[model samples]
Target: MSVELSVGKKVSVTVPGSSANLGPGFDTLGLAVGIYDTVEVEVIASGLEVEVFGEGQGELPLDGSHLVVKAIRSGLAAADVHAPGLRVVCHNNIPQSRGLGSSAAAAVAGVAAANGLAGFPLSDAQVVQLSSAFEGHPDNAGASVLGGAVVSWTEVPVDGRTEPQFKAVNIPVHSDIKALALVPSFHVSTEAVRRVLPTDITHLDARFNVSRCAVMTVALQQDPSLLWEGTRDRLHQPYRADVMPVTAEWVNRLRNRGYAAYLSGAGPTIMVLGTEDVAQSLLDEAREQGIRVLPLEVAGPVEVKVLK
Candidate 1:
């Protein structure tokens, strides 16, 4: 493909919001949803400019300190392509500071937008790499770059810089499997969630999660009826419960009602996978338990799309 030239021009990229670390796949799994954050970038004359219109509206910055701008800079540096000036507009619908992979979406959108405005110089894999650099993890970045449900993980080095390694696998999901997210009013920082978790886990917990993770991965291939078997975990959830008591309570309530629920990322969000028959009841149970719910279907097929 010859370069699609656009000098002193504009381009845009819209990246979907994601939910990561479903149960046993802690720090390694992510599912992209329909909700998105759209970024528009234009080459200009002198400096960087950013505008945010949704989600974090007043709180999100417009300067170089902004996460989107930082990602655009990273992409430019990686591709060695610099514009005279940049005009950026972000239509952000993803919730921030809520374990919903909002930062990852913004980072991927920034990088992808920059790459497009720079004439599609970098490949999709390279775009993933650049976004991963800004966000520091590939789980969410992978899903943002490659849409739908993606199982991904990171490999960081002791020397500081790292490589984000991920493979996009499209799994066929059974119809009844709905991913219901209960986002609490409270916020839990990834750092704070990590702080509350034990640095080292017990061998029993390790073994238990390993077995369940394997089962979960296999279950994705076979049947949604087996979701409960796949969603059980003993490793991270128990230790990270302090920031997620709402998750535990709601999940337990769901299990009792015959639905499978798990912690979505390092959460304040609880995810329950269920059928249409009981989906409403699950939501009702969660609300009855005083937890707020946002019910959405899982994004399937696992294909990557770069919108410009």
Candidate 2:
């Protein structure tokens, strides 16, 4: 019998979905949600075996090309270990391509599981680095890695290098505050949505968002009741509205109905943040509009736990 360079074993990792830019944080703020992507990694006698369930259903590939597999491979390569023959099973509960940080969850799950399978050869930092590398952004990946809520920034590393450093601030996400997600029965590419954003932002608008972002983080930390007044944005959302007219219209409706509605990432899904009563009311309106509403309780804490 031939000996393998890397001994593969089964490991599981779960990552919560995240919503970035909650309102004014714009590529800085991210909140982990109740939704998750679970990944099980096990050794196989052959090449990579990828089986996907839930969200990506018919759309995902069962090959090394998938984001999860790619993250695992990247983790292995970074640790200078040979990529092992493995079987990957993914249960994706978060909606993909709907601005719910689906790719971030998948990437985080893969790296976390790979690190476990590799006998912890890679440190947590390495895993974050690997995930961030593949994801091309740290906001989502960092939030997934750290859990809870993260506000981060990308900085050019020394020697003309580029990398991102993130800090996770534990904010008191209100228990009474619920997330009412209004998801359309359609898919929109993140690239297409990004294309609609203006390259240059006005100084006044930038200042406005900066002020609101500060207010949002502090308000969520101290008094979440201020969330409605705090979660305001002057950047990105308005510019990207052309790509998500339905979401925009619905957000306006929610706001008019006295709820705080904001774009969830590069959204086709608008998140209505409010108390239970407002959430229920928003849900009812979503039903009336034929929009499926996923009511997720405000996520509490930043840490990944194995469900099984």
Candidate 3:
């Protein structure tokens, strides 16, 4: 059954950007950061409208084609409701295609707004599931919705014919641990990056990643210092190094200097797990090299506010 949604009521949502595959936890772990993207959605009369600011002003779609609008419509439909025209204003601080989960934030914000307009028909888990499905992966979606640190994985269904569904848990992190992102000016397509990876891996490589992932999980919970050794991986990064040589270069450089560094999601953005002071120094150096970087804290969950 669908709830009766009111017109003209305003809802706003704030979502945090996420860095996925934090070290060896490929396709499984994510960290929510301080970078944010906000969307204010309101029911309107005739047609959909959108205004984009900051990151993708001229690049993003001005109509229903926008990811935010698409997510709202999808959520509303899932709840068995028809969408009236919506007026959406977005202020995006997270850089798109920088492995910062900008797309995940946009999807979550839209779903949150739609849920509010529909009298809160969806739960947080449902919203996260929808958002993850929209992004075609769970790591970024899980972190954007649940915040802090997220671990996600999929299992096959009982019927056997259907695709596996993902489940996630939000875990606590040490307060001192933070993220430093080095985002280059160039854009790297996530799809393009994935295409370069091999279809299979050796048994030794699989064992190596699993052992490191276990260490990463525990290190994030209680001892971040262990991350210097725990973040080492043999699964995805080695095979796909050529896709983003600069990103790999920096990761190797930092590892040589005894720091935990990993590719933030696919490519072109490298994430360093360290304290603010240490991360800040790297950010400064990146800026000097004409590369942009942002030091971010592990953010709390997403927030929603209703306008009076």
Give the distance in Å from residue 211's predicted Cα in candidate 1 to where it truly belongs: 1.5
| Clash pairs for candidate 1 | none
Residue-level lDDT for 107 in candidate 2: 85
- 1 or 2: which has the higher lDDT? 2
139-245 per-residue lDDT for model 3 (tens digits): 98889889899988766679988856656789999988988788888888888888887889889999998999899988899988798878888888886688788
The TM-score of predicted model 1 comes to 0.87
Q: How far out, in Å, is residue 16 in model 1?
A: 1.0
- RMSD to true structure for each model, in Å: 3.5, 3.1, 1.8
User: What lDDT tens digits, residue by residue, belong to model 2 across residues 181-229?
Assistant: 7888778888888888888988998899888888888766666667776
Q: Would you list the clashing residue pairs of candidate 3?
A: none
The candidate that achieves the highest TM-score relative to the unseen native structure: 3
Expressed as tens digits, the lDDT of each residue in 207-228 for candidate 1 is 8878877777666556666678
True-structure RMSD for candidate 3: 1.8
The C-alpha stretches of model 3 lying farther than 4 A from their native spots are 1-4, 158-164, 279-282
- Model 3: ten consecutive residues of lowest lDDT: 275-284
lDDT for 102 in candidate 3 is 86
